[model samples]
Target: MTSILPLILFVVISTVTPGGATTLATASGANFGFSRSIPLILGISIGLASLAAIAGLGLGGLLLEFPSLQMGVKALGSAYLLWLASRIAHSGSPNAGKGLAQPITLVKGCLLLWLNPKSWAVTVGAAASFALLASTPNRLAILLGTMFGVAACMSLALWCSLGVLLSQLLRTPGHWRTINLAMGALLTASIIQTWR
Candidate 1:
């Protein structure tokens, strides 16, 4: 239990941070409400857990050995994030009644984790740091996956709840638009953090 404290702290801090996933979840909650964001929240949690499992299976070592592969992933991830940011920035408010804009889908949410550099970093970092938590890679994978999945779910839900609260204060389309733009900008900024 003493040894596990660091891992728990790491997971909590990483998941609770204001990253791409959290920002998107917040926006989703504000735009569509908590119930509507469930799929996205689940998708992100599952995707991140899967990533940690895969990293435990030596994906991180593979990336270290092949620097070019890492660069390719970064490039692709950056492009995707930029595109997503643009979409978020231009999105209409739910209050606008703009033909009931659909919330982000489960599939997209999962895909976002795969393409998010920050997500990759967290999983890989956890897999590497907590490798000794279990006796074997398979066991490590399970541990990391379960831990990250639970932590991400809780943290993201909290972030989404915050957006729900914010939604109550933002009654106008213009206010929603401003928040959307700010969220979009923050998401874009996170990509810069990843590059750094």
Candidate 2:
């Protein structure tokens, strides 16, 4: 149990941070509703778990060994994040007249996890840091993946709930735009921090 303490701490901090998954979940909850955002939340948890499993299974080691490949992935992830931020910044409110922007789908939510540089970094770090706890790589992967999934679900739900609560105060397009701009700015800052 003590051996797993680090893993728990890592999961809690990673999930609670303002990353791609949390940002999108919050935006979805605010733009749509708690019910509409359920699929996105589920997708994020599953996708993050899958990524962690891959990392624990030793793919992370391969990426670390190939500096160029890792760099490429980071570049791509950064680009994708920038694009997502732009979309969020421009997204219209749900109550906006006809042709309202559609909410993020489950598939997109899952894809976001894959494109998120922070997810890859966190998974790789966790897999490498907690390697001593499991006797076998497979066991380590499964354990880490499960723990991450559970923690991600809980933390993401809280972010979404906070967004839903905030939605109550957002009565106009201007209000929603303000929220979206703030999210976008945070995401952009995350990208800058990643590169630094």
Candidate 3:
């Protein structure tokens, strides 16, 4: 626990960021409810935890050695975020057709996790910090994963509840569209932080 403080701190910071995984989760949960968003949430957890573990184990330094690799990662992250924004821009209402629900799919969830630059950075940072502080790498990885997992869930739940509230209160059809657009914009804005 003592060695994992930095990992916890890193995850808490990222989990609270505007365009983190919680943003996507909230948006999905709002539009389709918790049942439909489970896949996405799980994908985020697995992807983030795995990446964070890798970084904690010394993968980040190796990654940094390759400038092209870093550039590619950034570019991929930016492009993916832009694409998500576009999807939101084009999507119809969650309840557009009678009894129709556009649920969050596994593929999309994977994309959200795999392409999120902020997630990668946070994961790497958490890993690096834990690695530095822990006497054993395995122990550090578990602690980091546990800390991040809890913080991420709590933060995401907050956003999801907020999304649910917004969905119910902002009954106007256009408002839902706006919420989607807002999420997309936030994702786009994350690029600035991720790149820098």
lDDT minimum window of 10 residues, candidate 2: 96-105
Cα lDDT tens digits, model 3, 1-196, are: 3554555566787776667566677777778777777777766666666666666666666656887877877788778767766666555568675222465566666566666666766777666655656677776676666666667667766776777777776677778778777777776676677777
Per-residue lDDT, model 1, residue 185, is 99
Estimate the TM-score for candidate 3.
Answer: 0.85
lDDT per residue as tens, model 2, 1-196: 2378878888999899887778878887888888888888988898899999999898877777888987887888888778888887877677773222776677777777887767888899998888888888899899889998889899989999988988899988889889988888877888887776
Tens-digit lDDT track for model 1 on 1-196?
2298899999999999999899989988988999999999999999999998998887766766887887888888889878878877887678565422777788888888887777887888888888888888998889889999999999999999998998999977788789889988998998899788
TM-score of 1: 0.94
**lDDT-superior candidate, 1 or 3:** 1
Whichever of 1 and 2 has more TM-score, that candidate is: 1
Error of 1 at 74 (Å): 1.4
> Model 3 has how many clashing residue pairs?
1
> On a 0 to 100 scale, what is the lDDT of residue 82 in model 1?
84
Top-TM-score candidate index: 1
Error of 1 at 144 (Å): 0.1
Superposed model 3: Cα runs more than 4 Å off: 1-7, 97-101
